[model samples]
Target: MNKRKIIDRTLLTDLAKDVGLNASHLEALGESCQWEIGVDGDMLERLVEIQHQFERLAVMGDDEYRGFYIEVPRPAPEEWGDAEELIASGEYDSREAFLADWLAFNPMETRWFHVASNRYGDSRSIRVTDRKHTHFIITNHSKCTDAEPDDTWCRENLTRLFDYLQRMIDVIVANPDGFNDYVAHNLPYQQRTGRIAQKEFNRIVPNCKIEVEDKETAIKALEDSVHGRSVPPLETMTIRQYCSYYRIANEAYEAYYRKRGASGRFYEDPQDVPEELRDVAYYKRIKFVDEEILYDIDSPEDFIRFATDHYGELGLSRLNIFASNKRQKGWMIIVSNSYSANVGLAIEVATALYKARAPLLIYDAEKLLRILLEEDYVRLVPDSYHNYMGYQEEGSVYELPWEYECSEDTDSVLNKEQYQAIISNAEWQPEEQAKPIA
Candidate 1:
């Protein structure tokens, strides 16, 4: 069997230097030097003694340790709490069960054998003995007093131990052969080339607002913006409400055209229309065709294609509403308090649409929903019947109602099989619900 070489003396020296005086003093203790070769039975026994001495010094103050060290009292194994008593008390079924529960409760307690030392000659040792493949704590010694153990002393010591172990692991994992090969092939130009490449890439692609090329990317950016509190509350209309406004504008424009007997020239530029009527005609021509597209979208794939094709228009319309001194008007507050309320739903719909178009992109509906809820764009709409259901607003509760409470007599009248059949045939219709008061 091949034993992996521990870190070389040079690496240990460098680590000791990095950790400063405390580690330097610990290194001079000679025990850590034995660890450099390999952890052996002699070293382990010596570590156990060192650990006991450290524990004795832990409770001693400067005054107590002025001339000679003072030994601290510790509970013996027989004095320790009994597992069999806990089992007999009915807290646990068996000794094994009691021990399992104890282990679970004290997850942070070290079960592995290890040694730790610091500048003050304070060291800790832990050794576990295996009997019939069942590991039992043989000697668990620490340099801390009972009071000190409850404080940050144990945690800080553990951190130091972890740091030392991590350094050893890092050196063990380092590939000298691989490094030599890389150096032989790449030479001095490799580092310079990498730096130059990265610099040029950054120069070419300077950071600005993320250009939302696809629905998923757009949703991600929006979610990030929301979490960062950078997404200002949308001040304008919901998409559905905006569509209605557009329809009204179109109707008014048509009325104005018909009154003027300009039916033949209706297709002409809105600019050619009377100056007073231009605003009406322009709005009438504004393509609010999203509803038509969304209405027929039966699958996620179809939605994606539609979103990709109309990405610019959808984005522009959203932005234009908030534009300063914009001519668009008559946008009623519908379905939500602000456009922000609809943003989550819009993202969901858009993402579905985009995923339909680009099936290759990884889409996580649950993750996106979570992000929406976190940002307050959407909320978890509670339902007694359904386990998972969400919506944009409490007002949208009209869309999802509680399951109708059936009388006991009704259930008796319809047998289990008959009721199942009726339920299977039942069609849920939102239109039947009473309209929510705005």
Candidate 2:
């Protein structure tokens, strides 16, 4: 309705066509005239084209321009003589400086359109996150700001946002014990694990009293009490192996302790630990494997196998390992002999495809490769990247192969290309998976 509202390219282009004016002409006119634009006579026709182009350009995706970008240079005074006189002039060398001053003086005209239109299209994206919680938050730089608001205003807003986030983080940190207690009470699985662990622990460490604040000390005491009594020394069990034994001990304790007075092969009357310990269950289930294992594992089957094998020696049935590190989306796994090198490569790849927001997928490739090269699982030594077994190629753009067999359906799996496409075009609505090729 208003000629002044025609800011983006789509509306402008359409208006241009309707009024026998081209996009180039309207843009030229906009650059040449500071007069308040109004819908009248021939100008109305140009107004329509301007509005059309504005709408079209507003929705264009980021990658639609690829390598092409427009660099608008300031026009000489003689070229836009009339328009230049209408607007204030200053001793500014750069057009950006002039624009800054121009915007300071005129708020309404300055914030007309945040995005620009070019041959390829507009450059803006809308991002939503459910899968990429920590991943997105961590990757986000303080630099990026919204288009509609100026950078200084956006910075002020972000400062307030960050202050709020900091307060939230502080709140979470200050109440870890309470949070753990809540989880134990509210979460069924956590309650089960806690009860079982406490029962089993009591058998090994008789009259054990667990204070929430002394979790680490309690764990150490349990290990010390169990070593040379029911199980091997603290040194004998790797962290992973200890986790396996602890969980089995818990379950076994639960089985034996609930029916108190019953004799058990592992320990007698398994209620040696206080029942209060069961109120904070999550801490009792200590995992030996580093959080990194989540990135290395492929199928749920692989996770299960890893869990079973680690605990099997301790006569444990199955261990539950939560993959806390590897989240569901915005990340993909890459196996490499050198974790450091691969991490660097991942970052490079991420930057090359920044629009995609691909997170570095870490695996136990470094450890495994060292083991493979050494021909001994127990003894490993750091070696050069090329010396590792996973190093198949030496090129800059080398395609790293998966060490383990991946699922056949690649469509569901997040890859570089797919990630790039998604980030490059936020408006893209991926088609539902057609039936996989026969």
Per-candidate TM-scores read 0.19, 0.15
lDDT by residue (1-438, candidate 1, tens digit) is: 223343333444454334331221222222222223222244445444444433332232332220110011112222234777777888878877766655454332111121323323332333221111111111233222231223243333333433444443343235323322332342211011111121222232232111223545556533443343222322443333233333332343344446547544343345675664443344445653444435432333343344334322322223112111122232111111123323334343333333322111212333443433332121212221221224232211111111222223543433344333333333322111111112
**Residue 283 local lDDT, model 1:** 40
Worst 10 residues of 1 by lDDT: 66-75
Give residue 421's lDDT in candidate 1 (0 to 100): 36
After superposing candidate 2 on the true structure, give the runs of residues whose Cα lies further than 4 Å from its correct spot: 1-438
lDDT of 2 by residue, 1-438 (tens): 211231233432333233332212223323321311212333333323333433422233344311111111122333333444444554665656556665443322111111122222322221211111110111111132322223343233223322322322232234434423433332211001111122232233232312222334323322322231121112221323323323433443344334446554432322544553321221233333442344222344444444443432222322122222233332132212233223222222222211222222323323322322222221011122333323322211111122122234553343444333322322222211111012
Task: Tell me how far candidate 2 lies from the true structure as C-alpha RMSD in angstroms.
Answer: 26.8
Clashing pairs for predicted structure model 1, backbone only: 55-143, 300-356, 301-356, 303-353, 304-353, 304-354
What TM value does model 2 have? Answer: 0.15
Top-TM-score structure, candidate number: 1
